[model samples]
Target chain A: MNRRQSKVLRTLARLVIRLWQMRRVLLLVVPYLFLFGWLFAAGSRMDVRPGELYGVTDEPAWGSPDADHWFGTTVNGADLFELSRLAMATSVSVAVVSVSFGIALALLVTMLFVFDPGEKRFELPNVVGQSGFLLPSFVVLLVLTGGSGGSLGVAILGLILVIAFHLCPVLTTWFQEGEDGFDIVAGYALGLSRREIVMNRILPKILRRLVGVFATYVPVVVLVEMALSFLGFTGDRLSCGAMIAYGQGLIIEAPWMAIYPGLMATAVVLVLSLLGWRVSSAMRTGPLPRLF
Target chain B: MARIVLQRLLVSVIRFAAAGLALIVLIELAFCVIGGSDRHVWRAESYGPVPPGLSARPVSWAGLLEDRVRVSLPVLFICVPGILLIGYSWGILGARLRRFHGARLLAAPFSLFACVPGFWFVVLVAIYSYFHWKRPGFADDLIVEQGPDLLTWWHAAVVALPALAAGAASQIRAVSSVLEREVTRPYLRGLFMAGYSEEDIFYRHAFRRALPALFAAGDRTFSALAGSIVCLEYAFRYPGIGSLLVEAVRLGSYGGILVSAFVLAAFVSAGVIFCESASRLIKPEAAGG
Candidate 1:
């Protein structure tokens, strides 16, 4: 065999060993992958127009679980399985958008604080970070949206605002702490502009920590969405929270209606939380300093 | 030393007040925006409807003060104790559970439990109530009724257990990591050689060092509880500030929303401030650093 071929084989063998080491984490990913795949397929097949019933049929309401309808039907004749899949898709999108916006806002706030520590204008963001941690996201959403009966766009916008504001404080703290640990004085001595230092040197160094923070906050955002949906604050939206709420009445008569959605929500949350924990642990460099 | 501590306490109080004022203004502005009011007044009644024959009256500070206090009291009563209990229990359990070998495995279910949304608990309770309704027995009495009272407080506590457990488990993981690092320090080895029992070394030296971290974890747990309580209150349909806020939002009661938001923000800030002060008192040296 040629020497290049032997080098390629050795690299492949090392990759296999690494995969074996991560088998436990991979095991956790399997169910999430299966669920997401199913959700994608179901979401593609169904025409989901927000605030309009799509899956209603002539099938008996609260029907027992059978081959035709895998998770039975809601009292309104909406397919339980299809509703759950749609809910999952909506939840995933909401979480991604909110967390992304939250991270960007946090980074901006952190940069402002780091660069202009003396300015009184920055104090508002600091107070927000502190106070935001204390108030629940849903309370903020409800207050901002003025309760349910709004359009889907408004509801999603409200979710984004609440989640983003709620998370900004934690992320600001994380980034500020990370910046403190960096050698910014040395960067200045090397003739780097403040913006350049913050954007290129400091942010890249803390990128892993940023990912860790995102992981930690995603589960929180998901839970907040579910809670809001459960409260009927998401404006006629079908979410895991809504599905669970709808299924609660039929637990005994049609247990699958509640159980399937409950299990789906539970599974999604569990997987995300576990993944968050793993990512944070793996990326953590040393003992985490106290945020306060 | 006493003067220094007192000065620190004063600074914290001032900071909290400033933040509280800012939050009130923000909530007021939000109310104004939602109500389409150009008035700069903080009173809810500023944006409230007036009779056609009557002009918009000037803001009444006394009536506003009374209304704010009345709206805030019940929510505080139910939420304060519930949050404190959850934080205290989780902190204590986290500190104590660090020694077990199987703690990682044990924490898995708890972490999952923590991820269960607040409404899921509400749904579970509803389902339980349904089955209980059919049988008509003992469980029916403990379920929360329509209002926020001691009964609702108890129900909130019961529903909060899973989330609390999750918080405690995560805290345990964090505390244990810190403890593990402390154990590896050379001072611990010296103590082991100096005729001190392992338990004595742990309790007297190690646990003391771990207290600061544990207290920090407690702060995080308390913050989390603050968020979860809103959902719990909503699910139970309890007449707490959270539910009141939702109703106000639905009806577009700018005054109610403003009052509720201000009260909730103030309470959360106070809770955090209290936790910080308590943590400092628990470990004076750590606080100094």
Candidate 2:
């Protein structure tokens, strides 16, 4: 083949790769938007104040699904559709808070490794974190509650504490990965402190490589919040898990209640993970070389 | 080489065992502090005796522990082999499918499954049982005619299905990555040209080289499963340690927490040490990296 033929074929292949990446990004955005959407209606806020979404009503209870009630009414005469929206919002907000808090805690703890000798670095995070797997997060939360749950704010704070403790070791281990490149060796040879070499030379590279990985954990935090709620460990919070818990009870009467939130959680978990992988791949693929 | 690996394994066993013991003591002390007790709390903090909390009645830690072992051990046994076999098969499948739509088709679903949290699996299984069996909830006495430990575990094993899927999904990715790197090595091409049979090239070479990584995946999958035991037991009410934890927590029994945490922690420590040793022992040098 002539140079022109080879060049054309290469360009076509590059085009195909770009299209695939673009499709992945769009796929990620769609589910993300759905999670944040007020699927019941944009008019949910107009119908009742956000505060009233949680309150019981004297209106007809257990009403069937109709144009006005997308998910219908609960046994308490509360709007199931509006309550569902609130549950999702609570779940997302708590997830965002807990994940950010967890990462921050992880970073703080990982920074300590910079001061430690290299041999300890290998053993400390690996063995210590592995053993931590034995201690259940639910048990910790229950312990903190002293049997009965407290306020939602306190429960969220407790949730954040539990999540951060569990998450820190995982993040630290991931951050500690990677071979010592020439730059790191040079930094060490030049008599830089372990902290300086790691902070200045190594961390930036690891962060860049794992940036997409961080988003993948959001769905888990959401699900955990729901699980705790379902188990009645989250005090009075009505998150997605709580909604599932509620719907599970009324299954014979209102199967849609449980089904909708369960479907939403499933969608979020599936899509977010796919997005994370794509993002990781895209990062690895990193701007392909320009076609001649 | 064997001696060195054995020594390292022994050292690891000693190290993690010591750590687990120390952590168990620390957890017991910590709970004592939280529940507000005297030195007697520490004195009476023996396994199998589950020193009664402020109000909870004394329950035999041995029986509860036996329940946990019966359910969780089978899950672990079932899950580890499932991960290894499925991961190994899928990795081998990749080499054949490499020329066509393999990466997209094989990878995407596994990637999704791999990231699914363990509780989600419990929830999925719970949801399925709810729909299929028309059961409102899972409880120990819910079935009065419980059978032998082995038979009872099969009932509990209903929840292990999703866990196996998640674990196997993660392991598949690990095996595939290692296989891809191993098969593409320049030395492998030279062997291809030197008249080595494809079977020998794969099983005797690439597969052996992949053993350490496969063991590492197993180790990780085990740890992940250990973390999920509480959720699994809690959801299924399988008379495991997790159910014990729920009972303890509901009744505010610190002794219950103490025993349950100790058992699970011991299991994890033992598992981690075993897996880590095996992974390192089969270094590509021994297996031929």
- The number of the candidate with the highest TM-score is 2
TM-score of predicted chain A against the true chain A, for each candidate: 0.73, 0.70
Off by over 4 Å in 1: A1-35, A44-60, A115-128, A131-134, A147-202, A246-259, A286-292, B1-109, B133-201, B210-213, B282-289
Instruction: Provide the lowest-lDDT 10-residue window in model 2 chain A.
Output: A42-51
Error of 2 at B111 (Å): 5.6
Error (Å) of candidate 1 at residue B270 is 3.6
Please provide, for model 2 over B243-289, each residue's C-alpha lDDT reduced to its tens digit, 9 standing for 90 to 100. Answer: 66666655545567666666665665566566667877777767663
- For model 2, what is the error of residue B141's alpha carbon versus the real structure, in angstroms, after optimal superposition? 6.0
Q: What TM-score would every model get versus the actual structure? A: 0.73, 0.74
**For model 2, how does the per-residue alpha-carbon lDDT over A139-213 read when each residue is reduced to its tens digit?**
555555434333455456657766666666656655555434677677778899876777777677666654554
How would you encode candidate 1's per-residue C-alpha lDDT over A1-292 as one tens digit per residue? Answer: 6555588899999999998776755654565577568767766432453334323345545576689877776666667777777788778777777777767765665566666645353567766565456555556565544432444455566666655565566555555555554477788788888778767766775775777777777776787777777766666677777766665554566656666776778778777787777666655666432220
TM-score (C-alpha) between model 2 and the true structure: 0.74
The alpha-carbon deviation from the true structure for residue A172 of candidate 2, after best TM-score superposition, in angstroms, is 6.2
Fnat of each candidate: 0.45, 0.21
User: lDDT values of the candidates?
Assistant: 0.60, 0.60
Error of 1 at B251 (Å): 2.0
